[model samples]
Target: MPRSLKNPKKAKRKNKGGAKKGEASSSSSNGIPSIPAKVWQPGVDALEEGEELQCDPSAYNSLHAFHIGWPCLSFDIVRDSLGFVRTEFPHTTYCVTGTQANSAAANSIGIFKISNISGKRRELVPTKTSNADTDMDSESSDSDDDEEAVNDGPKAPVFQVRKVFHQGCVNRIRAMTQRPHICATWGDTGHVQIWDFSSHLNALAESETNISKDATTVSNQTPLVKFTGHKDEGYAIDWSPLVPGRLVSGDCMNAIHLWEPASDSTWNVDNKPFVGHTKSVEDLQWSPTEQSVFASSSVDKTIAIWDTRLGKSPATSIKAHDADVNVISWNRLASPMFASGSDDGTFSVRDLRMLKEGDAVVAHFTYHKRAITSIEWSPHEASTLAVSSDDHQLTIWDLSLERDEEEEAEFKAKTQEEVHAPTDLPPQLLFVHQGQKDLKELHWHTQIPGMLISTAADGFNILMPSNIESNLPANTAAA
Candidate 1:
């Protein structure tokens, strides 16, 4: 049975301030902080002496309660004040090349807002006044009369679809952080389509009703802007978080295209794509700190860091995995730190500041039993991350803590004694989420702390820590 992380065991203590052989020292001669060894185990919660605990197989179900069947290949959560998520699913059974022989149908994008129970139950009750012989008797009477006529009934929670657009088999969907109403999607057609719902938003404001419940499916409407440049199908697309209207996309043919909005309401595509990978470019991520800097992972088993203003050659490249690199995520809070998951069922973290030519990986985890499909760094917690794999599992990790030097030595000594033990566990494994089938992608909510949303072949799930308060809104901090 998998171990439960609701309560963990405390690890024994060890000494500090010493470096072992082949280990990087705390302070290097070059005045740079040497990258520490990544063998630390998961932190255990302290328990009383001689206390025993029982395990429950159903405990994992509490981590998430909401699940809906929506077969989607890729989805993105809007970073607006209101929590809205957009998911895109292939319209056909299989997504094929857009050639005339295999004319696969378009996909459907569904926009949804998670329901907020607390906001619905909240009633604005007017306070009672004690003034009977006030100077402004008419004003006081009007206020009292208004209060008497007010209704205090609780409203129903809002769970409705905002909109749905039927486009091509979108391999990737990304909502603009700066403009949450505007989103972009691209797929096998080698074309990127930009969709803007600013008019629909205005209609909702004027009507004061959610047309989302009636779910509008737009098929005939054309995209606000469309740009085509890739030779083959596009797989990865990301709008720059720092730069407005700037976009980057990667395709199956080892090509990465840059798109910028021109004054004529059309987008200007770069004459040349960022070409270096020998295989298909699987994923792309822009650095949270640097506007011009981005990273791309490929089937060639490497991840390349690129500067938009520089030449086509990568600024730095590293052999990231044994198999194809499926996903790459830049740490939102830490500069120069990024994580990659691969088809080898392993994930590694790399620090650009401490990177050397031969060894760029600072830490490695090999817990997932199958190939990792997606990886995301938490926006709320810098050291927290989430990974999804082909083995029908989603795991959360916390890498903020480090063990002391003496503790490290003791762990090594014990490992030498029990060489046959299962040593594949990651030190920072915090929570393991199961029960989903064919999991593809997972993401942390940008506005809500500790809330996560995942998409799979069977359905989509809205999950959180079991201890999260039920009354919290989709965008509010849980108690």
Candidate 2:
């Protein structure tokens, strides 16, 4: 008998919505998907029961027990159930797994075929597929209009992801201001590899031609361009959301290179890496509501906002943190406002127009017991931000309407637990990439507004929308 059938009955619905105490939720509406309950127990035990138990078949979310090494990551993407059953789209899904120290894995990039997205553990396909199949087009008529997502609580995704890129111990992944294209993945290797997701689609097309004899030739949209002008790894790269194809990349060399990606023939260096920070640059973000204006933070304990059209001097500077600035995010809901986290085990948000020091911060987001790695704003929602850190935790912040701060106590950062509540709108989130090991990078599926792909410190994960009802699932509305 097959393992899936051994204890075949669907595990009792612990709760159709939230996880038990000390238990984590699996899906991600923001960029960092939380660890699944199924994988968490074994992991805790692994820390106690030893490595073998961590590798046991029971570790898989499914009875069939597909084991993703202990240090893996999962991303949540979106999909079209009807199209998937008809095989219209790639239904591309993935999970990034890592190699233990001294393990023989070569730090690879991977994509998995996911037919279902209803649980924490995902089923993998035998053969590889292209990484295209997303909803990049600002306009589209080809979608499952009747398809609905399952647990579309705040921030859940309702699309699909096709491809991913991974390198070991990633430094950061950032979305460019450019339209439907441009994302950067960097590390300490002195090499900042900017993945042109548009190109991933073409790679998929080329691979498709070699596989099925009847497969039709599809479009091959490559990443607009890739760059390697730095002599060292660019610690930070940001796209001028105001101008498509324009990028600014920086490295430990203390130099910022402006890139014209379309032609790749020109680059301009800021007078002196936007001097005045007086230390190494750590993180950056383009003002969500402003064009050509962006913010940068550094170990010098300050934050600087710049306008590329203006001279090399920072437009405004603030000694925002007591330690190295780790992550920065411009609030999308409020103008002239942004947030920063530091090594001091604290985080703060500032208003560009204000000169007050710590007095300028709107929310003091601190729950991660450690340094925050990054803070990403929701492209679709204002004030809603996602934070990830070395503390092995992901926290979501909503400044609009507090859900009664009186509710839950164990749910850090957030005053309460959502219990995987339901939503009236379709999930607009793309990928929620929570790494199995230390998280390195995350990417959103282009073309598909609500899909995502992620590369971890280990491998890669392609997330699809399982909360969305599937046409193939016998009990789905589409069925």
Candidate 3:
């Protein structure tokens, strides 16, 4: 752990679920074990001890939830945010990764079916005004728009864990199109497994504690592909953004490997224990827009850009941050623009073209009070970026030198004319939790601009940004 972080659990509880009074409950429906409800209604009365509440078992039309896992890290690198992907169909299900606190062994993973869910739950944020950060229409326009609101009904008990896989929790999860499955790599264990939604029922049955051997069917078994290449606990995996049958993985070894699954259903390694850093390789990203480009980060405090087509040292290596880099992301629409987060508790936007060995940071943001845990650049928008951290907050930043109206009109106009005028500016986070859990990994739905999704350590999450204002909700007042 970086000496910068004293208590890994010293969570700041920024966007939601912090205070009481006037704060409306249920911001973006994220972090629930099951898929969230289409509608969520707050209770008329305050929650009492031992009380349970029922959450929508189906995808949250408007909201979701997650659990507080180990202090070592979170459950999922991808958290339930808004608009990653959501459908009204009841058959659509999401998965959550689990992590055992302080385990040297890789944390196991778990599966949760939204269907089996229907129990007591609580609004992470009990206050109404405090949750008012992003949803301008949620408070006043939903009723007029004729969207059915959550009934101001009685509450139920909070959710509990039901399933465990691989004996630990997932550190990161990525969807591979070729395998057409979700691939999860645990925190302590150096193993990665690929699972499919088709295995939903089998995983559910296998996960249940009371379920007997009487269960039958092909869907109940989770067909797995475990890669034994990484010697240390694996940190991240990205399915080849270009090729379908190939995948890339990184680990504490400070190197990346390409795994080719041949026709025989067996896997072959094309790269050896290549080395890049002296510390753990925390994250890696293969650029979808570029076939030969990839970016990686590590606790060793360096960022490397590799052309897998080449064999020697990285084509470009930048001393990125003072602490461990947790995640790396690239702007698909913008060439040479990428982002990275670190334990030093900051994130940087670097222009690969302008980046130099020691001069790594192009623009930096330091709002997070804890280590920046995860980061993602907009797939469509160039200037918008979203980040999550150990501090339990998600922030979007816009880096356009253009958005700065205060810039000397002469300078701004000059830069605009001298430089290629982009249809957009820098990066910006459009909607925060609107009052919800800390962000984990965030994915934008294939084509939806405002819709995004995230998964927390606790459970499942799917989010849709509401037509709302941009501001942290009012502070939660004590009851």
Top-TM-score candidate index: 1
Query: Taking the tens digit of each residue's C-alpha lDDT, what string does model 2 give over 1-479?
Result: 00000111112111111111222122243445444222222122233221111111111121111222222322322222232222223233323222221222223222223333222322321122121211211111112322323233111112322423344433444444433334555544565555545444344433422222112232233333345556565456676656666666666554555665544433343334555566667766777667677778877888877887787778878778777886677766576667787876577766666555444766665455566665665443565555555544334455554543343234322423233322321122211223223333344332232233433333333333322222233322332
When sorted by TM-score, best at the front, the candidate numbers are 1, 3, 2
lDDT of 1 by residue, 225-257 (tens): 777667787667788889877888888889998
For model 1, what is the alpha-carbon lDDT of residue 304? 90
Query: Which pairs clash in model 1?
Result: 42-427
Please provide, for model 3 over 1-479, each residue's C-alpha lDDT reduced to its tens digit, 9 standing for 90 to 100.
32111122423222232112221233324433432212112222344443333322111224433332332233322222223332322212334444444443433344433322111222322222222222211121111213222343212112223333444435555655544335545444577655544354354434523221113221233535676667777766777667765667887777677776674245576647546677787888888777766777878888877886787357777788888888888787786788888887778888776664457467887656677766877654577677766554455555653444444345546434332123232324333342444345666544334334454433234444332112222332121
How much does candidate 2 score in TM-score?
A: 0.55
Model 1 local distance difference test score: 0.58
Candidate 3 is scored at a TM of 0.62
Off by over 4 Å in 3: 1-61, 66-96, 99-108, 111-164, 182-184, 195-197, 201-224, 356-360, 401-439, 456-461, 467-479
Sorted by lDDT (best first), the order is 1, 3, 2
What is the lDDT of every predicted structure here?
0.58, 0.42, 0.49
Error of 2 at 239 (Å): 1.5
